[model samples]
Target: MSSPLHTQPLAALRRQLLSRDISPADLLHSVEASIAQHDPAIGAYLQRDFPTALAEAHRADLSLPLGGIPIGIKDIINVKGQPLTCGSKMLAGKFISPYDATVITRLRAAGAIPFGKLNMDEFAMGSSTENSALQITRNPWDLTRVPGGSSGGSAAAVASGTAVATLGTDTGGSIRQPASFCGIVGLKPSYGRVSRYGCTAYASSLDQIGPMTRSVADAALLLQAIAGPDPADSTCRRDPVPDFSAALQGDIRGLRIGLPKEYFGDGIDPAVRAAVDRAITLLEAAGAELRPLSLPHSSSAIAAYYIIATAEASANLARFDGIRYGHRCDQPENLRDLYDRSRAEGFGPEVKRRIILGTYVLSSGYYDAYYRKAQKVRHLIRQDFAQAFAQVDVLLGPTCPTPAFKFGAHTSDPLQMYLADIYTIAANLAGLCGLSLPCGTTPPTAEAPALPIGLQWLAPPLGEATLLRAAAAAEQLLA
Candidate 1:
């Protein structure tokens, strides 16, 4: 039997706790029970400390916004005293965070108990958790398929009822894609809306931390706790944090929703296209105006995203040299040999591929042609959204081109795997806030069960209030 605590959303648990119907300790135990029952099959968690979590729950102050709620942290995010592996051999057993990420500090202030080290793509490089050097995280809905990553573990934990909510970082579609695959809600706040301080950097310009939860309201609650500025993250915006939960009460009547023509064309799976079309129709029926618009630069998004992201990743990952904290070579003949061997040994194949691509793009001869041009394209992509937002309140479309794929399907072709993020990377490149929520599912085959489809909504930077309001209003319709 599933624990009631595990099955309920964060808001429901908060209400129950406030009413004295369930204690925080009870919630913790329920989470433990759920993890014990489901984690073996899903492989969502890298490590969990139930004793520490339980103790915190027992002492939790229920009055705080997130008091006693155990929020799972993606391996890339730092939590004081916890293992800080980015799902690579480099830091697996070697690194312990000496301080909390700003987000962790915010969560703690909101009374949330940070619990486990969730699995992720090594250095947040891949779209599937298969890149994790530790273990593969499978989709809870269909174990044969991948949980879209590098936030796969976070999404699986929520989808499998092992976590009420969790934090996932998005550089491209890390949070939103996994949520789409796992049939949950994932939000990637606009760049600088949330602090990046202490988060292991992937592509610095594109990454943003957000919440993955079972419901949009829960996402709002969690986002409320974590969305704010911090001096520690100079990139974090100083915009006033609104009552995200309160924004949910607003209706979408007369809201202008944009349907980017480019997103509907070509490679999208027929089922995914149909489902998202239905979602747009439903929103239209719900009093939203569907304006077919164009993000003309959309065709260049994937190419530009890879070039810029990899280039930034090349620079960000240079800090992991053998001498400091991560894995070191056994015995080095020289410094160069030590550096080469240590990195080669620590990083997975996918990580190495990205680092190499990044390095090549930023190489002296290629910088102007690739990296610089990609940055220019990135600006044009952002301008595309700026122009679209002038005509609409939000942009709506399919989150992923297809539902979760079976394991090993794209492993042989790295480019195929890269295309899995085609629909999502633009939001990051444009530095816009976006969300993914379950809209419907594809038809089940004799050999395969129906997999969930997701509809994504994008808002201008710091426009999460408008984003959440529209999403909450559509949640019931989509359901």
Candidate 2:
């Protein structure tokens, strides 16, 4: 029999805690037990808070909505008194966050306990966790492969059951890709749907806070807690977040689901195509209509994305000089050396590469050619989505054209690796919401497991409630 803590659904989980059938302390212990067994092999957490988390868990109010569920916060986001290094060597020993980020404050108010800070790619710039300056977060199913990135560690934490849910930023494919690899549910809400006040910026326009969890319902529960406007972040949406958990009844009958033609072509793996086909059949069985759609400029998404995203990253990361804090190299002769070495010694290779590319693209003469052209292409991409959604309620595609690849598969060539995020970059560039959910796991009868496959579901800005209601139906039928 499964433990009461393990068997309970979100509602039952909360109920058991409220009735004292399972105390928050016992749940925290289970979390630690899970970590002690899984993390060494998985690299899920950047830092674990045992005594502190247990103490907080002890005081957890069962009446709270999240019910004292343990949460893993990606390290780039602030957690009071915990390290927010953003997973780089420069921030090796940095300590203490004096105040909570807006999202952090909200999570606490919802009665969730933060168990630890998870890892990520340096400065949230890469698609694979392999680029992490500190550690590589590997796939839970197959250690040889990556748990997609830059929110990799967060995905792995939830996949391995180290924490019930986690918070991550989706600047590009950061959250969804990793969630896809880990076989869980991840949502990158419409840009500005959640406040970015305490979250570190990757690309201001592209960055959004979101949840990565074991189920769509759990992700919905978290969105309810975190999705409201905050005075500290002017970018936040003023629209009220409807009761998402209540909205997930899973009736997708007659809903139009688009199958983007460009997303189903040559570069995709056979296994991935097969998995998405099965998912579509299941959605069809659920009474949804699946039709072919097109996003022609989709081919240019990576080229345009790198140009815009890196330009923003280069500017956002300039503040980490020696004088300001975070990380500082000792003994500088002048301000120039201080800035030069602090950044040189501080940033990882992938970060430096992006910063260099961004600087080159934005430099005086090239801006109009490379950067401006990319913007025009961005408009074309958004228009493509606008045209498609006019006929479809939700668009579907492969989250990644292939399953988790072996570590070091595309590390040597940046362009080759960027293709891994092709299916996802368009959503970020269009400033829309998208999700990735487990459709199937390969080698159905294998003793050890190969890797899992995912299906992508996308909708216009602020359509998560609708998108997830459709996904909830699929999840049940697929199971």
Estimate TM-scores for all models: 0.99, 0.97
lDDT of 1 by residue, 1-479 (tens): 53556568777888999999999888888888889988999999999888888889999989999998899999999999899999999999999999999999999999999999899999898898989999989998899999999899999999998888899999999999999999999999999999999999999999999999999999999999998989999999999999998999988889999999988989899999989988888888989988999999998999999998888998999998999899998999999999999999999899889999999999989999998999999899989999999999999999999999999998999999999998899999989999999999999988779999989999999999999999999998877
Clashing pairs in 1: none
C-alpha lDDT of residue 59 in model 2 = 88
Most accurate candidate by lDDT = 1
The candidate that achieves the highest TM-score relative to the unseen native structure = 1
Query: What tens-digit string does per-residue lDDT give for candidate 2 at 14-116?
Result: 8788888888888878878888878999998888779998888888877889867888898888888887788887675764677788988999999988778
TM-score of 1: 0.99
What candidate 2 gets wrong by more than 4 Å, as runs, is 1-8, 444-448
Off by over 4 Å in 1: 1-3
C-alpha lDDT of candidate 2 relative to the true structure: 0.86
